[model samples]
Structure formats: structure tokens, C-alpha cells
Target: MRYYLNTQTDPAFNLAAEEYLLKSTNEDCCMLWRNHNTIVVGRNQNTLSQINPEFVQKHDIKVVRRITGGGAVYHDLGNINFTFIKVGEQTKKIDFSAYTRPILEYLNQVSVPARLDGRNDLTVDGLKISGNAQHIHKDRVLHHGTLLFDVNLEMLATVLLVNPEKYRDKAVQSIRSRVTNIRKYLLDHPTVEQFMEDLGRYMQKAYQAVLTRFSDDDLKQINDLAQKRYRQWDWNFGDSPAYDFSRSIRTPGGTIDIRMKVKEGTIQRIRIFGDFFGIDPVSDMEKRLTGCRHDHQSIKKILNAVDIERYIKDVTVDQLLHCMF
Candidate 1:
């Protein structure tokens, strides 16, 4: 028998749900729900290459890589995320079309007017509103998708760069045309909670399985899984692709040049130098930064733990941090 779980928006929780479903041995299927206000890239994507580092640093946003295969996507509270999991039978090849058919059927029943276009997108009219990806385990398959309802379109485009101008000028179309929000078309689309309720009811009817809330045991298991893997740097960013990153930031003090070679989202090497002044020891900061996970908070925390005046001669903490990323 399958189960249905309504999860929270925290990336930690959604990732835990993915882990649980893929690890389960029973031949069952389920739906995992969540929403996020961040950027999520596929497992195979190069984090440094897929995103605009300057934009992300300016906005104080997060970027995480999921254990799935697909292009990058932006998620906000206005979006709805769904994950469908099923343990496949070894005797037969997995039929992705058959698995996603119920989703198309449910949307039609709800008057949402959606169609499965190409391999994994749900489109209405000619615009894409949903992008989905899959990850298969030993015998389990997980299909997760982002449902754009009222997501901030401008923010999405600004954060996810189609291609850096320094790269090939392949005549890239703007992301605005690539993704559309359901609120643009649905006059009375309900809130995420209400939509989830309706979706659960509809899915129960479609799959002919009782919709049961997650139990105490299930919640505990998911929580443990999240702490052990999902929230860890090793799984979220450390496995992303390697790339060279170079960015410049102008602080109140002066301009700083930040160059880094990142492998799997980990800071393999970093060199920070600029016209700004700092009191902390350059050697100490460089050593601390080289092996740490490439995250804003983590880097800041490491800097805080050290004596600021030993290396930098006169730069303020804020100025130094502005240049770190």
C-alpha cells in the first residue's frame, strides 16, 4: 500500500522524504509536498555555472542541488512542489509516461487545463507551468516537480542566468518565456494548503488508495534522515559540478576581487585580494576557507571565530564579508 505525506517547505524535510521513499523496500507509491523560496539545481548541474553568483550574493539567497536530473528552477512560497515515489518492479522497465498520466488526469479534473509536453513539463496553452525530474534507486523511482502558481517571475529570471554574456552568445531566450505561473490563467486557484487538500482527495480517487497522514514514526524517521544527509553539505552542495568563479564586489572601503576554484560546490581553492583594508591574518582566513563548504553563513561563521585584527590591517567586518563571497 502507498502513503501520502504533506511535508513542510524546508529543503531539509523535502529531501528527507526523497531519501525515505527511495530507501523503502515495499512496492508502494506516495506524494511529498513542500514549497521553497530558493533556487534548486539538478544533481548533475554545475552550481557555479548554472547560477549568477553576484545576484545570489546580493540577495542573500540559497542554492541547493537535489538528487535528481533536470535543469535549474526557482521556487518561492507561491509555488507548489510535489514528489511522487514508487518502488518499481525489476521484471518490467519503468514507464514514466504511465506514471505521470494520473497527474495530467487530475489537472484536467480540477479544470486547470494542463498537458504533459515533451518529456517532463506540464504546459497550459503554450506556456510551461510545471517542471519535473526523476531519480531512480535500486528499485524505487522518485519524480519531483515544481508547480508555478504565483512565483515572482522577475526574481526567477534575475537569479537564474540563462547564460553569462562572457560565454557563447547562443541567442538564449529569456527565462520569462520558459516558465509561466498558473495564477496568470486560473481565476480562482486556491492557496497552497487548500490546493493540497483538493489534490490529495483527487489523487486518492484516482489511485484508489486511502489518503492517510504521516504517523509519528514516519515523522521521526524523516527528521532523522534529514539531519543525517539532506541538511549536510556533503549531499546538498559538495556533490555539485566543478567550475571556476570570479566575481568583484565594491564595498564601502574599496573594490575586492574574489577568485575561486570550486569542485562539487566545495571551495577547493580561494584567493581574496582587493584595495580594501582588513586586520585579520590573510593566511589564517585563506586556510579556513579552502576546505569549507561554499556557503555564505558557513564562511562568515569561520571568519567570526578568528581574530579579525591579526590579518586585515583596517577593514571592517562587513567590508571583509562583502568581499568573501
Candidate 2:
């Protein structure tokens, strides 16, 4: 087994790095890295409905879609990310316990008392400290997880405060849990940087792993992968499957209700119903909104050409967009 040390803080690059290593390497390997403030959602998740879009945009948080099928997770420099990539038989690839056991052993050695609990998570005393997910590609499997050391739990709570009633989809929904940081339980209270170093060094010996650096070609491959897939808005947000969205808002003129059916990230059909007074027929506006992305900018662009006062007497584009989202 070998260990790849990645110090880059870009979430896209880090995620792409894992995929590149998974496909290129023949040896059983582990990747230890951290990312800047990011929200990584599962491949099968409805990213739009799983996050606070306003908060995410205001705070400049990078949202990346990972290859695994699991709930969305918040990542920051205070957290540690680990990946175990191995080429093995199909039977052993889906064993979550087999992959998480090493992590539990490490936490025990450090006297953290963390254990592999229900499904795929590491909990300290009952509060979750880690979330794990996996993806199988042909004959290989990639198992990865996040360990919260001193993550900004306050911001995490705020950013993840998404209203579940807005959209209905078949996508995997994230289960909220009582989460805590490793620093609170550790007696020494080591910095995240120090903990990452110590963990990497320990894994090298415990697994008889060779510590290797990425070559220039290897980095180029990772960068290309990041650019093409990890950093794309389409992959991160637009990949969500078809869903029904219904939201209502009170405006200065009156109340507005928007019911939209979105498929492939674009509104396939829309029906606007409300007590708002409009000189023009609401059906025309719904037609305009049809085929547009269910996004602020996309909706705003279509509304830009319409005479604002004609649709809703006093409602502005921003107000309508806010209500729909």
C-alpha cells in the first residue's frame, strides 16, 4: 500500500486527485488531504435543494459533486479527508466496515473512543465525528470520508439549513445528526495541521505504506479532471434529476405562487397562480419561464425583457426570483 500526500486546499482539485489516483494506480493506496470551505454533495443528490443557496453564494463556498452516493457533507481546513482506493474482487468492494475499521482503529489508538457505528459513520460517545461514503468503478473501489477536527459547526449549521418542503425528488436525502469535533474530545487538543501529519505518518507504517509524491504528469491529469468535471456548475448543481418545485411568497402587490416541474435542470413546465394583479396574462409569463433553468440568473434574464410593471404591478425581478428559489 502507498500513501499520497496532498496539501492543496482546492476542493475540486482534491476530489479530482482522488479519481486520477484511483484510475491510474495499481497498488492499494490511501490519500490524505484537506479542502477549503466546501460543500460536497453525493452524485445522486439534489444539490439545489440540499443547500442554502443564498448563504453559499454570500460566503463564496465551493460546491462540488463527488462520485460517491451519500449525503452531502461540509468540508473545511479544520477537517481531515481520507481516501482508500483498492483494486479488489467485487464481493469485498462494498464492505463499508472493512474500509472503516482502519479508521476506527486509528481513533482508538489516539484514545478518542470513536467507533464505527450504524451504517457508515464514526461516532464519539454517540455524536458523529466522521461520515464515510464509497464508489465502485469496475474492479476497483474508492472509499473516502471526512473527520471533523475543529470544523466551523456554526457555519455548517447555517449553510445546511435548507428547506426540504420546497422541492420533491427521488434523490437521496441527507440525514441530520448530532455532530461534534475531534478537538473537543482529544486531551492534547492538537491543531488540525499537526493531526493530519501524525495520522499520515501513522498510516504509512500501520499499512506498510510507501509515501509517494505525484509526478508532473500525474498532477496534470488531476488538474484536467478537476477542470472538466469537479469545477463545473453543471456537474455540481444541474445534475439533479427531475423534481417538482412549489413555492409562494408575499409581495407588495399580492401573494405569488410558482409551481414548476424541472427536468435536466431546466423548467419543463410552469404554472403561476396567485392573487397578484397582472395586466398581461400569467400564462404568457409561464411560457416565458418554461425551458429556462430554475436559477436566479436564468429566470432574471427572461424577466429582463418583460416590462416589470406589466407582469406583477409592484414585483421586481429580484423579488420574484427570491420567491421562486
Candidate 3:
């Protein structure tokens, strides 16, 4: 097995690296890496429904969709991420224990008293410390997980907090659990960096793994993948499953309720209902919104082009946007 400690903190590049390693390489590999403040949503999840969009935009938190199917997870510098890519039988069933055994063993060696809580989580003292997910590509299985070392638990909660009633979809919903940092349970009180290094060393020794680095060609390819797919809005948001969004906001003009059906990130239909008086029918405005990307900028452009007050009295474009989004 080959082990690598990825030093890059860019979430896009790191996620791209996982795909590159899983599909582009033949050797069995393990990687330990980190990312700056970011939210990684599962491939089968609705990205908009999994996050608090206002909080995400206000903090400039990056949102990316991973290839694996699981719940959304928050990542920061204090978190440690691990990935294992192994070639296996194409017909083999998913096995969580096989990939998580080493991690559980390492935690036990550190006196953390960690144990697998369910099919895909590691917990200590009844509080979660890790969440894992997997992806199968032909004969290769890619398993990755997140370890909360000294993460900001408050930030993690806030970013993932979304109104359940806003979106109706068949996408998988993230199960919220009480999570605690691993550092608090450690007797040595080691820094996050130290903990990551120790875990990397343990994995290397356990697998008889040889340390490796990404060559210039490998890095260029990873970066190219990141730019072309990982960093694009289409992959991050447009790939979300079809969902129905409904929201109502009270403005100075009156109350406006927006119900929209979106597929592939494009609005298929929209209905406007409000008590506010208007000179023009709201259906005219709704028609303009159909086929537009369900994004702030795209909606804003359409709102700006028309005299919005004619349809909704005394309401500004920003106010209408607040209701639609």
C-alpha cells in the first residue's frame, strides 16, 4: 500500500485528487488531508437543501459535491480527512468494517475509547467523532471519512442548519447527531497537526505502506480536474436532484409566496401568490422566471430587467429575491 499526506487545503483540489487516485491509479493508496472552511455534500443529495445558503454566502464558505453517496459534512483546518482506495471484487457488497478497522484501532491505541456506532460512524462516549462514506468504481472501492479533532462545533452546526420545510425532494437527508472533538478526549492534548501525523504514522506501519508524493504530471492532472469539474457551479449545485422549493416572506409591500419546481438547477415552473395589489398579473413574472437557473445572480438579472414594482407593489428586487431563494 502507498500512503500520502496531502498538504493542500483547497477542498476542490483535494476532492479532485481523490477521483484521480481512485480511477487514474492502480496501486492501493491511503491519504490524510485537510480542507479550509467548506461544506461537502453527498453526490445523491440536494446541495441547496443540505446547507444554510445565507450563512454559506455570508462567510464565503465553499460548497462542493463529492462523488460518494452520503450525508453532507463540514470541513475546516481542525478536521482530518482520510481516504482509502483499494481494488476489489466488482460484485462484493459494501463493507464498512473493512475500511474502518484501522482507524478504530488507531483511536484505541490513543486511549480514545472509540467504537463504531452504526454502519458508518465512529463515536466516543456516545458522541460522534467521525462520519464515513464510500463510492464504488468498477473494481475499485473508494472509502473516505472525516475526523473531528479540534473543529469548531458551533460553525459545523450553523452551516448545516437548513429549514426542512423549504425544500421537498427525494434526496437523502443528513442525519444530525451530537458530535464532540477528539482532542477533548485525549489525555495528551496533542494539537491537530500532531494527531494527524501520529495517525498517518500508525496507518503506514499497519499496512507496510511506502510513502509517496504526487509527481508534476499527477498534480497538473488533478488541478485540471479540479478546475474543470470540482470548481464549477454545475457540478456543485446543478447536479442536485429535482426538488420543489416554497418560501414566503413578508415585505414592506405585502406578503409574497413563491413555489418553484427545479430540475437540473433550472426552474421548470413557478407560481407567485400574494395579497399585495399589482397592476400586472403575477403570472407574467412567473413565466419570465421559468427556465432560468435557480440561482441568485440569474434571478437577479431577470428581476432587474423588468419593472418589478408593477407586479408586486412597493417591493424591490432584493426583497423578491429573498422570498424566491
Best by TM-score: 3
In model 3, which runs have C-alpha deviations exceeding 4 angstroms? Answer: none
Candidate 3, clashing residue pairs? none
RMSD of each: 4.6, 1.3, 1.1
Per-residue lDDT tens digits of candidate 2, residues 1-325? 9899888999999999989977889889998899899999999998888888878888999899999999999998999999999876465446789888888888889899998889898999899999999888878889999999999999888888888889999999888889999998789999999999999988898899999999999999999999999988788878987899898999997998888899888899998888888788878888888998877678888999898678788998888888777
Top candidate by lDDT: 3
Angstrom error of the Cα, residue 28, model 3: value is 0.6
What are the Cα lDDT values of the candidates? 0.70, 0.89, 0.93
Candidates, ranked, lDDT = 3, 2, 1
Give the per-residue lDDT of model 1 (tens digit) for 1-325: 4657675778777777777767863656667476576777777766545667678878866666677777778888877777677766553343557666777787777677899888778899878888877777776777778778788988988888734532221222223347787766656867767776777777777677666676788789988988887767677666765666666767555676777777755778888777756665476678888987776677778878887656565556666665544
TM-score of each: 0.78, 0.97, 0.97
Question: Predictions ranked by TM-score, top down?
Answer: 3, 2, 1
Model 2 residue 97 CA deviation in Å? 1.3
User: Once superposed on the true structure, which residue ranges of model 1 sit more than 4 Å away at CA?
Assistant: 1-3, 48-64, 91-96, 158-177, 250-255, 272-288, 301-317
| Best of the two (2, 3) by TM-score | 3
